[model samples]
Target: MKIIKDDLAGTEIKALLQEHLDDMYATSPPESVHALDVDALRRPEITFWSAWLESDLVGCIALKSLEPGHGEIKSMRTANIARGKGVAKTLLQHLVEQARSSGLHKLSLETGTQAFFAPARNLYLGYGFKECAPFSDYRLDPNSVFMTKCIKE
Candidate 1:
């Protein structure tokens, strides 16, 4: 799979993001859902990427710069058809390498506390992220599970 910086203009990617939004809403309450839609993912603060396998979209992930030396992982999703194929893992490792190259000292993310999010939580933990208090603009919320990892330079 090839992971490249996405320009947010592909019809395939747009459809994939729509599917991602639909799934998030299906699994999360309206008030507790924090997944970003296509428009939100286009923000200048966020650097987005889409994984592709011979023109088919497999997954996507983003890094949102929060402050000097800090970044937040966002919009991570694997295509339903591509699940269990290491797409998320590859995208995550790509983001981690990008963070290191960008001089970031920490990486953080906020995911749901529901069972639907277990795979994601486990994936992050396997990468060395540990549960942490809310950071950036986030506040305590039972629906939210925050995790962070210090980048070992």
Candidate 2:
């Protein structure tokens, strides 16, 4: 798979992001949904990347610079056709590597607390992210689960 920095321009990626938002809303209440849409992902502080398996858009992920040496994960999604193909894992690894190389000392994310998000929680946990209290502008919300990792390398 090839992972490339993105600009939220391709129809395939836009469709993937829309599907991601749709699932977030379906799994969590409106107030609990923190997933960003295409426009939000295009913010200057967010560095987005999309993965391709040959000609197929397989997955995407982003790292939003929250402050010096800190970043928050955003828009992590694998296309339906790419599930179970290690696409999410690859995208995550790429993002983490980039963050570390770019001098980010920490990485964090907020995900749903429902059963629908079990796989994602497990993925983050396996990658050394530990559950933490809300960070940044996030406040206490039972519907949200926050995980963080120290990546100073």
Candidate 3:
């Protein structure tokens, strides 16, 4: 598998993101949804990457620099066909590595508190993320689960 910088214009990637967004909306209440739409994902602060197995897109992840020493994980998704194949893990590892290399002292993410997000929350915990109070522009919300991991410099 190879992870490379995504230009956010690839047709396959665009569709894949749409699917993830739809899935999030399907499983989450409107007020609880924190996943960004395509327009928000294309913002200047976000760096996106797509993981591929030859010609097939397996998954994608993004990193948003929120402030000095801080970064946020955004838009992490594994294609339906690629689930359980380690695609999401690989993409996440890549994002964490990038965050460390970029001098970010901590990486944080906001996910759902519902069962729909258990797998994702577990994955983040496995990678050393710990539950934390909301950061960035986020405020306390029962629907939101915030996590943070300190990246060694």
Query: Number of the top candidate by TM-score?
Result: 2
Model 3 per-residue lDDT tens digits across residues 1-153: 999999888899999999988988998888777888778888999999999999999999999999988999999999888989999889998998999999898999999988989999999999899999999999999889999999985
Q: Which lDDT values do the candidates have, in the order given?
A: 0.93, 0.94, 0.92
RMSD, model 2, all Cα superposed?
0.6
Model 3 alpha-carbon drift over 4 Å, by segment: none
Which 10 consecutive residues of model 1 have the lowest summed lDDT?
27-36
Q: Candidate 1's C-alpha lDDT?
A: 0.93
**Per-residue lDDT for 1-153 in model 1, tens only?**
999999999998898888888988998888877888888999998999999899789999999999999999999999988999999999999999999999999999999999999999999999999999999988888989999999857
List residue ranges in candidate 1 displaced over 4 A: none
Q: Per-candidate RMSD vs. true structure?
A: 0.9, 0.6, 0.9
Per-model TM-score versus the true fold:
0.97, 0.98, 0.96
True-vs-predicted CA distance for residue 92, candidate 3, Å: 1.1
Clashing pairs in 1: none
